[model samples]
Target: MTPDAAQAWLEKNFAPWVLALSPRVTGIGPGGAVLEIPVTDAVARVGGIVCGQALATLADTAMVLACAGELGEFVPVATTNLETRFLTAARGQAVRCEARVIRAGRALIFAEARLSSLPEDKPVAAASATFFRP
Candidate 1:
């Protein structure tokens, strides 16, 4: 899907809280998607570092977009499993998530995501997820 359509899909489909993160779809193509979320106070913890929950949410959302790109359209899919590993604290910088579909089966989809701090490009988190297409 095109970037504009991806952005519109996100805005229309995601929850208000998820949309509150202000995720922007920068790129999208078959099997891959890239999204950026600003590091604002809403997503920061007491230390001003981006929280794990927000990171995970971003990863999950990016992977969903990747799945949509792979399928060439947005379809409802449930996350069967999601794993996230935090590598560093994301402070004072926007976060970018790059997600790609690892495999797409008839009833399942496997994807992985890497999140990094912008400009510095320092790794912040890595995530893998499985989605059930019903």
Candidate 2:
């Protein structure tokens, strides 16, 4: 899907709380998608580091876009499982999530996402997601 359509989808389909993260679809192409979540104080916990929940949302959201790219359009899919690994802390800027659809099949899609600090591109988190067509 085009970036504009992806952004519209992100705005229309997700919950209000999810929208609060201010997800922006930077790119959507052949096998994957790129999403950026601005690091706002709202997403931070006690410390300044962006929280894991925000990263998880980024992973899940990016995977959906990646799956859409693989399918050539958007469809209803729910995340069945998400395995997240926090590699480092992200602070002071947006976090970028790059998601690739590892496998897309009749019933399920498997995706992997890497979260990194924006501009610097320092790896911050990784996630593998399982999405079931529903």
**Against the true structure, whose lDDT is highest?**
1
For candidate 2, the per-residue lDDT at 18 reads 90
lDDT of candidate 1 over 1-134, digit per residue (tens): 79999999999999999999999999999999999999999999888899999999999999999999999999999999999999989876799999999999989999999999987999989999999999
| Candidate 2 local lDDT, 1-134, one digit each (tens) | 69999999889988999999999999998789999989888998777799999999999999999999999888889999999999989876899999999998899999999999977999999999999997
Show where candidate 2 strays beyond 4 Å.
none
The Cα RMSD in angstroms, rounded to one decimal, for candidate 1 relative to the true structure is 0.8
Cα shift from native, residue 78, model 1 (Å): 0.5
In order of listing, the candidates' clash counts read 0, 0
